[model samples]
Target: MSMREKIKVAAARYPNQRSAIMPALLIAQKEHGYLPGPVLEEVADILGVERIWVYELATFYTLFHTEPVGLFHLQLCDNVSCMLCGSEDLLKHIEAALGIEKGETTADGLFTLSTVECLGACEMAPVMQVGDDYHGKLDAARVDVLLDSLRAIAPRAASVENTSSQQPGE
Candidate 1:
């Protein structure tokens, strides 16, 4: 679909044009797999807002990808609670398993490992978010299992146009 068509769909969903920013961004990301400058501007224009507004929204939210990211944007919480529960070790395991450092995407563009603050699931410390799903109480073994699960589901997810896909250069 064209960019205009995509923005239109997003704009139609909200009562206020500006309120559609998030959903519009999601649609833009679905089409391109990341929110590049052009996409952000396109969204802003369609919503009758300034480009900086869109840029601000993208930067403020960890969920939005300003640069290219992998198919799975893995966010591990490293808050005090999670750290006490061995989140650091979990982070190490994920980095090793994915062969990418934190805030970096795998060469294959399959995974991007990142560290986040509290995920609000301290009870399930050492938690990580893969795409929109959260996996908690993770050990190396469980992390491996989660990766496997993600791999298994990735193809299906990519086939759905609205679902997240691996970003280019990831």
Candidate 2:
């Protein structure tokens, strides 16, 4: 379905069109991979709302990416709980393994790494979020497994090249 049609369907469930901004943005992001100015304006135009409303939500939420991201977005938790539980070291391990610093995407465009305030799973401290799934209790080994799995399912073989075999916490 077209983005306009999808937005209409999502807006139908909400009493106010403004309420549908999130789902609308989600639809737009899925279609465009990122929310650029034109896409944001298109969403606002379709919803009959001001551009700011849509823009605000898009910028405020971490889930919504205003800029392009890789095929996989790795959001590691950096909150107190996670930090106390060794997130710092884990972040370094990921950087070394991927050979890309935080806030950067690998040259192959398969992975983008970021640090988030929290994943809201303190019980699973040292958590990492990939797409919609939350991976908790992370250590070097677990992260390696996750990265291997992601690369295995990557759209291209380029995703597997140039990655380090160095284990986390080694």
Candidate 3:
């Protein structure tokens, strides 16, 4: 079924079309991987709302990705608790393993690394999320195991080649 058709059905259950913006954005993201501008415009048109509304929602919420993301988006919480718990080290491990830095997507498009203010789990410091799963108490060993498992699931014969050795997102 088309995105519009799906969204139309979703909107029908809501009190009004506008109330379904969040769910519609999610639907669009599911279809497109990320909520690009054109997709947001289409969603707004379907909802009979202004394009700005869709754009605002997409950008405002961290959950709504506005650009292309890797197949696995690893969001590491870099807040005070997580940082104190060694999220920086965890970040380094992820960067070393994925060959990408925060705000960078792998050339293979297999992984994207990003930092979030909080994962809302202060107790689980140094937490990282891959897709919908939360990985807490991260260390070098665990990071390697996680990467290995992901690699085992979908082995990439070659790691993403870095175009420039310089820091990513420059």
Estimate, for each residue in 1-170, the C-alpha lDDT of model 1 and write its tens digit: 56678688868878888888888888877778789888899889988988898999988888888898887899999999999999998888888888888999888777888888877888888888877788888899999988998889878765663443434353
Name model 3 segments beyond 4 Å from true: 155-170
Which residue pairs collide, candidate 1? none
Candidate 1: list runs displaced more than 4 Å: 1-3, 153-170
Better of 2 and 3 by TM-score: 2
- The numbered model that scores best in TM-score is 2
TM-score of each: 0.84, 0.90, 0.86
Report the poorest 10 consecutive residues by lDDT, candidate 2: 159-168
For candidate 1, the per-residue lDDT at 101 reads 88
Q: Cα deviation of 104 in candidate 3 (Å)?
A: 0.8
Give the worst 10-residue stretch by lDDT in candidate 3. 157-166
lDDT of 2: 0.90
Question: Per-residue lDDT of 67-158 in model 2, one digit per residue for the tens?
Answer: 88888999999999999999999999999999999999999989999999878999999999998999999999999999999888885533
Give the alpha-carbon lDDT of every model: 0.84, 0.90, 0.84
